[model samples]
Target: MSLGKKLKQLRKEYKYSQAVVARDIEVSQQAYSFYENDKKKPTMPVIARLARLYQIPMSELLNAEENTKEQQMEKFIEVLTRRIWAIIDLKYLNNNFFDLCLVIEEQARISLMSVQSREILEKKEFDLDYTTLGKLRGDYLEPFKEEIENKNQDTELIPNLVETIFLKEKEIASKYFE
Candidate 1:
């Protein structure tokens, strides 16, 4: 599946026509058509607008075809779990809740890395560095620790967790590209 095919599939799934998507993203119909045809790539701003219009994460739109089936499934499960947790207001649970959340978060990361590693190996034909993956996994796992600690200690730690996650992701990405 190419990016263009993914875009077309998403558009159809969302019940959107080229003209409607173009109008929503403030691009001319021809330009949007070109994007769908893979004849031209959209600017970052246009991509952002399209992502917003489609109510999807920017990465979903940008890396749609690149993601493996396992990665996609893991992402879907994570999103669904989060939504269910939010809807049920699970945050009000006691100390045990924090522990449960921590466990879930850890499992989610392990699942994510497993999917990502499988995708890389299957599609890219390379043996990824397990040490790097382990380091990145630690980096990814730290936020859950912070979240649990914040809940337990009554401190504002979400910002720090997010920053740490971003830095770790960057580090992991650099290693992969190297």
Candidate 2:
């Protein structure tokens, strides 16, 4: 994913048209198109504006790389799942495991294609269906939950947790692309 593709993805995720993004970023529509098409790079100011618009750190926007779609999706899943875990932990700070699982189940209604589809329910190049979701939770999230429980909420353990999740997702996602 180049920065252009990242911009496009963010725009689509936010349901912003190119024109809307152009107006928000104070760039011409053609210039924004060029940026999304990889024909031109945006200046730091433009990048900063885009970062603000996307509500993400500028570092995330600027650090875009040319990775395969599989790698990108794997990374996306890992980041999202970790964020979900963190949210669950915060929301259930009373340490009610039952409530946590209930929240997780409710969140599971989320469809993955919101990030992948050009049109909702009309097209899907890839989707995280329930089967894969089950595998992911069983293979990665459960173990990570156990590990976190054992670690007693040590922040320093996050990197290792992320690495473990990433590796597990990579292994599971291999079947997905094939």
Candidate 3:
């Protein structure tokens, strides 16, 4: 099903009105209606928020289907590259350090696709070298992995970055919905 239909089904299943879901996500009722109508696409941030709100994974919220290795790599690169650029933009904006960390986590999740792709390439007894596999992981993947581990647990800032970005994304989502 399309994301909008899925969202509407979930909302109805959960017994939530558009206003209720919108208020929970800090958006207007009309905006939520637009989202349900598939008149607009949510940004990564809003999609993330919806995933959390719906208590599901981001991929599930996006209605993303599993694909063959080639397709997966393409998607992995798309998400990974966008995250890399998001980190650079955050740095330029002087956003919090946790913003970078969150972007890194996002990248790492995308990088998991490489492991799947490698397995497919090897066709059984995977014997890929570290360097070759690392290259396949892409430049940003390692840094993201390292930062995710190194990120401070006390700050509780990274989780908030998703919400902060979502609020901004809601505006863009609204335009698409319209």
Cα distance off (Å), candidate 3, residue 138: 58
Lowest summed lDDT window (length 10), candidate 2: 108-117
Model 2: per-residue lDDT, tens digit, 1-178? 5788778878866789999999999999999999998999999999999999988888877777744566556645744585557754573444444444444433432313323323432332234453445544554555545544543655454456545644554454444333
lDDT of 1 at 23: 91
Can you give the TM-score per candidate against the true fold? 0.41, 0.48, 0.36
Clashes of 3: 3
lDDT of 1 by residue, 1-178 (tens): 4566657756764678999999988999999999988898888999899888768788877886677665555453544355334422444234243444444444444433432433444454333444335545554655565454345554233345334433443443333232
Give Cα distance to truth, residue 117, candidate 1, Å: 22
TM-score (C-alpha, index-matched) for candidate 3 = 0.36
Candidate 2: stretches off by over 4 Å: 66-75, 78-178
In the predicted model 1, the residue pairs found to clash are none
Candidate 2 RMSD to the real structure: 6.6
- Of candidates 2 and 1, the better by lDDT: 2
Local distance difference test, per candidate?
Answer: 0.56, 0.61, 0.51
Maximum-TM-score candidate: 2
Clashing residue pairs in candidate 2 (N, C-alpha, C atoms within 3 angstroms): 1-67
